[model samples]
Target chain A: MYLHHHPFCPHSRFVRLLLAEYGLEPELVEERVWERRPGFLALNPSGETPVIVEEMAASVPGAFIIAEYLDETRGLALGTHRLLPEDPAGRVEVRRLTQWFNEKMYVESTEPLVRERIHKRYMSREQGGGSPDATSLRMARANLRYHLKYIGWLAKARKWLAGERLSQADLAAAAHLSVADYLGDVPWDEDEHARDWYARIKSRPTFRALLTESIPGMPPSKTYADLDF
Target chain B: MYLHHHPFCPHSRFVRLLLAEYGLEPELVEERVWERRPGFLALNPSGETPVIVEEMAASVPGAFIIAEYLDETRGLALGTHRLLPEDPAGRVEVRRLTQWFNEKMYVESTEPLVRERIHKRYMSREQGGGSPDATSLRMARANLRYHLKYIGWLAKARKWLAGERLSQADLAAAAHLSVADYLGDVPWDEDEHARDWYARIKSRPTFRALLTESIPGMPPSKTYADLDF
Candidate 1:
């Protein structure tokens, strides 16, 4: 299997973490999605990153679908670390929290900050890339605090984000937060419990690849790679 | 079970369809999400609609999560009409298409069009509701055509949107299109195959309630309730 992704994309990073947890190592290819390369567009007409080509040569697009696919296939093979729970109710909670971070938090926080801080520096002028917009950055920061509080509230109530066992919910939240942390945008000091929960997830072996990924023009924050952080 | 929703919200409509398919009828309550009523906010902090309070009184939020919950808990009882395919690859395809309609089509077409046409009239002057934005409507119309063409391409290629049997993918797509159709916004003539596929879905008994729903000052289109359309 081969994975086409952008190093800094949170969705791509989410898929990577899920793959590592499932014990499958796919060949990685970096894709410049903003450029809309014809080859990549042929694979995914939506022009998004984190498209994976299976061994049978079929392309699978979107992070959520890829994560579910891995859990259904490779997850069954491993017989451990199921990203989703067996019970219907458990699955619902996990999926809810997963969407919470991936959809709501992403649209409200991650995308705006990442677009301004990272993508803007690399994109061409015609693509609306220039100096970062101060308003967008400020809005993203404000949104981040609200999200962190919610995460803290969930952490206080459950062993994991969704429940007792680790699931894709944790991975999804970590994926988005990790990207924000790379830019030093996450205010870890604001919520101690949320920070502690993140610390536990950050220490996992599945997160190693993501921690070490270095973008060409923009480097990760000082403590991004520190497990003790 | 009790479902809090709005008449034209696609996500709320998506959950309603899923419930009908699963043989569950939750008492429906219309919510004006823009108003941000405190009581509704307590049920879902995000203040989004389609929050279903189960018989046990647990609040299940989000369309995707609620659908999965119903499928997991009740799918075993009926022992037929599984909205998600059992096979891993087939499940991936179904989920991929589901997200395609729910996320891609929604952001690109439905939300913008609905906000401009319907929601804007209901909103107050201070809340930025007055006249429709011509540019937004035009962009949404153009985006809708592209999405319809994609749907047509998929309909022509597969037995259903996801595969052989009808799945949540079909329902999710229909839910979004139905809302647009209510506004007389869908250009059915542009895509013959997609129109035919929609006609089949629209004829389902599960769609009966949605067709008869009337929103006071904003009734459905002339052909909205016609199965023969």
Candidate 2:
């Protein structure tokens, strides 16, 4: 399998974490989505990263689609360890929270912050790149606090974000938060419950790759890879 | 089943269409998401419409989540008529396109147009509602044309949006576009293929409810409910 992804893209990070948890490694193809390369657009007309092509050449685009596809194809192999629960109710919660992180959180915070802080560095002026927009960044930071609070509330209420089992919800939240944390944008100390939850997930074997994968010029925060933090 | 939704909300419309297709009628609870009612927020923290509470009282929120939940729970009964195909490959396409309409199209066109043309009329000044922002409307209109062209291209190539069988993808696109059409915003003459696809889907028995659902003062366009249009 080949996965077209960007290291700093939160959605790509979410899929990468899922692939690692499933123990199915794909050859990662770094895609500069801003470039809107015709070849990449052919693979995914959306021109978004985190599109995966199976060996049979059927390409699946979007993180949510990939998550369900992988779970359906590979979940049985993992049995009880599958990231998605088998029961419909459990699956609903997993899917809801996954969407929460991927859609809501990404829109309110991650997408803006990443675009301003990370993507701009890689994009050309013609591609709408420039110095980060302070106004957008400020709004995103304010929104991030609200999301972190919600995460803290969720983390405090359950052993895992969704339930007893470590489901996709945890991975989704961790994936997005990791990207924000990498930029030193997450106010980890503001919410201990959220921080504790992050610590637990960050220590997992699957998370190691995310900690190590960094954008060359923009170094991750001092505590980004520090598990104890 | 109880579905908390707003008539003009594209996501809610998508789920409503799906429910009608499955022959399951829901007691629709109209929610003004801008009010942020605590009870509604309890059901869906995002404060978005289209949250469904099943007979068993399982509250499933978000359009995409509700779509998958309904498919998993009711799809088997539909057999060949299931909106999501049985195979993983087919399912992925259905999901990807469903998201394209729900997420991409909503962000680009439907949400902005609806807010500008519909929701703002109902929202109080304190609720951050007023005259539509011209800049946002202009951008959304341009995006809508691009999206319509895309739909036309896809329609020309496939028997249905996703494939030979009618799937969630078609429902999703039609749902969003239907709302745009309601406000007389879609340029149907510009893309005959898209217009033809819309006509076919809009003629379905399941689409009747959508045609009749109208806001208090904002009546649909002259051609909104016309099957031949």
Candidate 3:
């Protein structure tokens, strides 16, 4: 299995955490998808990532096709802790939150930060000299607190944001936060449960590779990798 | 079971499609959630529509939650047509496509159109707008084409959007396009596959309720519900 990802991408990080937690490490090849070409675009025409490739028949579907393939082929669901619930009602909650964090949180919170704080430097349009807009960062900073408050409410109610089990919800949240933490944007002290929950997840062995992630000219905070954070 | 929904809500329509496809009907109660003083908000602090109330639970999750409940409790998944594929890999593709339509396409495409073409009198300053901006709508319009183009490509490649099997991908895509069709936002003539697919799904008995939806100040195009169009 080959996973095409960008090093600092929250979506990739989210998928990586899942791979780590599940103890399945695929070979990772980083792709700068924004620097698009015909070959890479064909992998995901939408030009998004953490695209995982499984050697399925050509007729099969793609990214998600690979996930379902991986989950079933590896018998990942056979574990005592299932990523998705078997009970239909509970599974809905799992899937919804999995998407909630992936879509809503990504849109409302992480994407803004990445665009304002990170993308300009890498993309050719705003390559050099001009600083990433402080105003956009401030807007993201303002919007982020409300999002944390929302997540805090969820963490307060359930053992996990989605439900009683640690599922994709945790991975999704961690992925965004890990990327933000790389940029040093998350205010972990603001929400105790969210902070504590994230810390617990990061301390696990699977998170080690994520903690070791480093970007040039940008630095992780002193506590970025600390299990105690 | 009682479902709390508003007719124009895309999420509500998504669940409605599931109910229609399965030939299972749940009692519906309309709630003007924003006007409720701390009541409905307590049930779902996020305060989105398409919430379900089973016999015991205070507020069941959301549309995704209720749809799965019906699919399981009523054995709605038993039909010759399956929303999710039989295999896990195929199932994930359906789920991913479902979110792709709902989360991305909705935000990028339908939202701005709805706000511009509708949402003015029925909306408030606090509901994120009192007036829809034309600039945003223009951008949304451009983005909608790209989204449609992507879907057209996938539809062209597979017998169904997700795979050879007709699954939740169709329902998810249909859910949004049906709403757009009701408002007449979709340019049905844009692409052959998109038009053909839209017509096939709209013809289903499940789409009957959506075609009949009436908003307080706005009316749908005369042919909004016509399968022949």
Largest DockQ belongs to which candidate?
2
**lDDT by residue for model 1 over A79-186, one digit each (tens)?**
545789876677767877888888889999999988998898889999879999999999999999999999999998988998888899999999999999999988
lDDT of 2: 0.91
Those runs of model 3 whose alpha carbons end farther than 4 Å from true positions after fitting are A57-78, A126-130, A147-164, B31-37, B57-76, B125-132, B143-160
Q: Tens digits of per-residue lDDT for model 3 on A18-60?
A: 7776677879878776677676677665667877765673222
Cα error, candidate 1, residue B140 (Å)? 1.6
Clashing pairs in 3: B83-B168
Q: What is the TM-score of each predicted model, taking all chains together?
A: 0.93, 0.96, 0.85
Question: What's the CA error at residue A151 for candidate 1, in Å?
Answer: 2.3
Model 2 / residue A52 / CA error / Å: 0.9
**Model 2 segments more than 4 A misplaced:** none
- Which stretches of model 1 miss by more than 4 angstroms? A76-80, B76-80
Q: Candidates ranked by DockQ, best first?
A: 2, 1, 3
Q: What order do candidates take by lDDT, descending?
A: 2, 1, 3
Compare the candidates by TM-score and give the number of the best one.
Answer: 2
DockQ of 2: 0.80
